[model samples]
Target: MVSSLQKSMINLTQVLRLREHQKSFKELEKLGAIDVYYLEAIYQLKEPTIGTISKLLGQSTPNTNYHIKKLVNLKLIEKRIDDVDRRVTHLTVTSRYSELINSDEDFWTRTQERLESEIAATDLAIFQRVLRQTIEIISEESREDTISD
Candidate 1:
């Protein structure tokens, strides 16, 4: 059951990613694939340091640093000096990055509206509850994996 669910989720992700890629071709050209991936990691991690990002990405510090420098130059990401440890820096995606990435997207909102129109309200509510529960479970598992690592 879990394996089937995982496959379905993977398929859904691939479909969504394809749609996003089609929508963001210009942005993709502006930021190379690797840099965009690094930026995504930084954004999702919410202000992780170089070491933490390197570990999460399974990348060498120097290689990660190189991409990070490029992102910084592009003004897509900024480094913040850790308040307690001045030597340590945390990475955050900039407002410009968010604007560039999300400003032109309303596909999700449109999809939600379509779903509301097509699905019965009670069924949609149950689907939403299941989706929320699944997300929470995944988040908890991710946290556990991060903690163990």
Candidate 2:
């Protein structure tokens, strides 16, 4: 059952990625796998500094900086110097990056519309509750791991 659940999650992720790639083929082409990965990390982390990102990724500062520089050059991300700590720089995704990546929101919206049309309302509510629980479980585990680290 767990394996099946994992497979479904993986399939969902692949489908989303495919949809995003199709929607932003040209912009996606300009980005390498590492570029996208780093962009996602930065986006999720909100305003992580270079050192924080390096630690989270278990990568060297220089290696992380290389990709960060590439992202900045591509205008996909912005680096802001910390106001309180001048030496620390925080990373943020740019509007261009949001525009390119948020195509997946359309995919989700469409999927929800279709699901609402096909599924019974009660069943959909139950599925939604289960999905929320799963996400919360994963988030709690991630927080635990981060705290431990």
Candidate 3:
């Protein structure tokens, strides 16, 4: 038995979440069909080995290599051979990605400003906590599923 106000709040939250997700999907699409996992892997390790990136991305070595090659060709990232181990290569973001990073920062800053203007700090804090908890719960569920399967 939810009050009308409470139901409206729920709907508003749902709409906000959906809009954010759609915006993120669009940003990724604009980034040239790059895999989110690969982007995340690169973000986590600014300059990482192909093996490390593959493991972080949960992709095969060859698949990761292929995608990285494409990224290299696009001039979005560069590959450098390890000094100690010439056979091993590491991936690093290229100068071409400076614009991309700036765009991402602008997007986040604008979104944060809007949220700050519209939402109370306490409300935003609570929402952030809930989002973190939800992610943790989902991760645990996924781990359990993987173990069982």
Residue 11 shift from truth in candidate 3, angstroms: 14
The regions of model 1 sitting more than 4 angstroms off are: 146-149
TM-score of each: 0.84, 0.79, 0.54
- Model 1 residue 86 distance off true place after TM-score fit, in angstroms: 1.6
Question: Which residue pairs come into collision in candidate 2?
Answer: none
How far does residue 140 in candidate 1 sit from its true spot (Å)? Answer: 4.0
CA RMSD per model (angstroms): 2.3, 2.7, 7.0
lDDT (10s digit) by residue, model 2, range 18-134:
766677657657778877878887887788888777766677889999989999998889999999999999999999989876656776798899999999999999999998998
Query: How do the residues 9-123 of candidate 3 rate in per-residue lDDT, one tens digit apiece?
Result: 6897688657645656433453444454565456546677887776655678899888888777767778899999998998887766655555557767998899888999999
In candidate 2, residue 56 scores what lDDT?
Answer: 67
lDDT of each prediction vs. the true structure?
0.83, 0.83, 0.69
Residue 111 alpha-carbon offset, candidate 2, angstroms: 1.5
Q: Which digits, one per residue and each the tens of the lDDT, describe model 1 over residues 10-96? A: 998899778768776564577777787788778877888998777776789999999899889888899999999999999999998
Candidate 2: stretches off by over 4 Å: 104-106, 136-149
Q: Model 2, residue 2: displacement in angstroms?
A: 5.7
Clashing residue pairs in candidate 1 (N, C-alpha, C atoms within 3 angstroms): none
